[model samples]
Target: MAMRVLETITNMTQLCQKIVHINIRWSVLNKVPFFRQSFRFLWDRILMCSVGKSIQYRRLHRCASSPSPAAIECKFASGDPTTTCTDYDKDSDLVALKISLLGDCQIGKTSFVIKYVGDEQEHRCLQTTGLNLMDKTLFIKGARIAFSIWDVGGDHRSLDHVPVACKDAEAILFMFDLTSRCTLNSIIGWHRQARKWNQMAIPIIIGTKFDDFVQLPLDMQWTIVSQARMYTKAMKATLFFSSATHNINVNKIFKFITAKLFNLPWTVERNLTIGEPIIDY
Candidate 1:
């Protein structure tokens, strides 16, 4: 009985070895384009049921034991795992500015930021729950300025947190949807609320979705633009018409603000033609 048990144990060890060898061959075969799609489902199931966990454990252990020195140095230098060594510049002046976006819900505040930052646009508009923060570094006039942008949710329930988020903000962008009169009407309230939190921050009124607004009848379009201009004057804020989807007036808005704040010179191109409109977008 002892001899039989020993033989069985030896056979089982040999079988596991053969299975491992076959798995290795299968791994190589799985990389082939012709076999990949056909074998992927079966390979995944086999790995999950047999060797996946063990292989992952071994790999993690190996990595834990021997971390690369270059990676360690990079981690220490940046102090942020998401930031790489190349992203840091020793000679650039790092000025941190906080800007808050305030507006009614679905008015394209988040969309505008994403477009300006060169991020992919979401197909569906997402309602911001409380506050969404994004960071961007801009190099203007040989100076590096880092902007910390906060997008405050426009929902009534989220409005309570707006004051807290707006603290220490250097500027506030109050946006409204040009196609929605209700959103435009709500701009004054949003501006007041933001000013209550940070009075020193410069305020700018942004009229979004201009592409859709322009498609309306001439009279209706003029009405909306006139109302927006009135609000801009009343609030003593600069007004800009923008379309994030079309990448219009997005970068120009930020550039104008930066130039104004830093006392930098910015030249505006004028349209000499009498009947033709100036194309600034």
Candidate 2:
């Protein structure tokens, strides 16, 4: 009986080896470019499986009524896996959000991001040459949210560069300074151009530096609010005002984004427990 079982196991191993060899040859026999494309397709399909760790919609909502984004775009350079996350398993939808801040130079776009990410105050306020990116893992209810936030230069000269920044975004946050009427006026043109380029559904209009003036005239504030509301309503977007310096309504902006992008309830404290420390899963 032992000899018979050993013979069966050896035969099975040999068969498996032959099958693998045949598959390798078959894969290589295809055109080299075709083989390369097929390999990439398979790799992306495998990564899509990780979406199981991401949000799983109970029901698909209409485009007009969907609370969260339909996809998420993770930022990963050619060889940098340290920053990008792949914790989700198969069958996950990738939500891609492209956000760009446009206003005159020194409108506090970088400051807003630093505050949102809770970066140190003295951290070098380096002018974003082209684009800067930061990732934040958000929790909407118990669901995991990974957002890639891109901070683009807001100078008018950068307007030509905006399309590249806003390309393929599921949502966008258009921010302008509360105190600068010129900055406020530019939003209309910017919004029109961005909509033409991206044609995205989810958008947010933000007024930054609310704490700059003790009290902005009611009419001035209302005018800015009305302008933003008009555009947001036209684009079907949410609107908000925030101060990154004082940390006022910063969480509110995040909550709005989480709710809009993931359709999940917002919470300040995260409840995720670290199991075994994964060196590299």
Candidate 3:
């Protein structure tokens, strides 16, 4: 009888393990990317309080009221699961800025974005397949603006599908390399395509590799800038000459975007735009 009882217990454990594996697989395929992260986070917390040392974690959390470093770290590392959801909650008016990059392949579009968010520029960037979506929240003045930037594929073959990914963007950043004439020429087509996605939105013309322009003929460089500025001005778009390698006015671009979109007073700096309006539209 004891042998039979032990056998039954073992079978139950095996069954539970199989069930857990199947559940994880389903979650990974159907749920958000952060679902696994959330599971791991909850599991870690549970383990810390149970099998692991509970008092140490409690002290760590107590040191920081509200969201502890541990919690913020988890959110940053895991990314907010809310952003991946297909539909956002309509009740809450959380302003979400959809930004996309438009330029030729290998034109430092991805590098530029990573530099803004990661604060570093490296040539080791792999081609973005389909789309790469990331979120960063900036606190300007007093409000918060959540930026959901999508780095779409810059491959020539991928141009047809690019507009679909850029739908509902609050702004589009058309990036071109200062040294690459091919990338610079592609900007016109990219801008036309992006306009189809969001007609009334703002477009920011960004000239990458601004540092390298000194090596090129000054007249040629100014002519390029003039052509870009003319196109942007015609479309009522903003233009900026920036080098991600130098981090010049990278902060200013985001801040100015906040001010333009939210129509906040220009005096406040480093302030996030508030999503909630006093009067509901």
TM-score of each: 0.61, 0.57, 0.57
Error of 2 at 207 (Å): 0.5
lDDT of 1 by residue, 62-98 (tens): 4333324343333223223243122435622455667
Q: What lDDT does candidate 3 reach at residue 159?
A: 80
List where candidate 2 sits over 4 angstroms from the true fold: 1-98, 120-128, 139-143, 265-281
How much is 114 displaced in model 3, in angstroms?
Answer: 0.8
> What is the C-alpha lDDT profile of model 3 across 1-281, one tens digit per residue?
99999999999999999999999989778876688889988986787557532333243334423433343233333124432232333412234577777888777776677766663212322345556666565432222346777787788777866776677677788887877777777888888888877886677877777667557876777677667667676767776666777765454566556556655344222211121100000
TM-score of 3: 0.57
- Scored by lDDT, model 3 comes in at 0.61
- Ten consecutive residues with minimal summed lDDT in candidate 1? 272-281
Q: How accurate is candidate 1 locally (lDDT)?
A: 0.67
Full-model lDDT, candidate 2: 0.58
Best by lDDT: 1
Cα error of candidate 1 at position 87, Å: 3.6
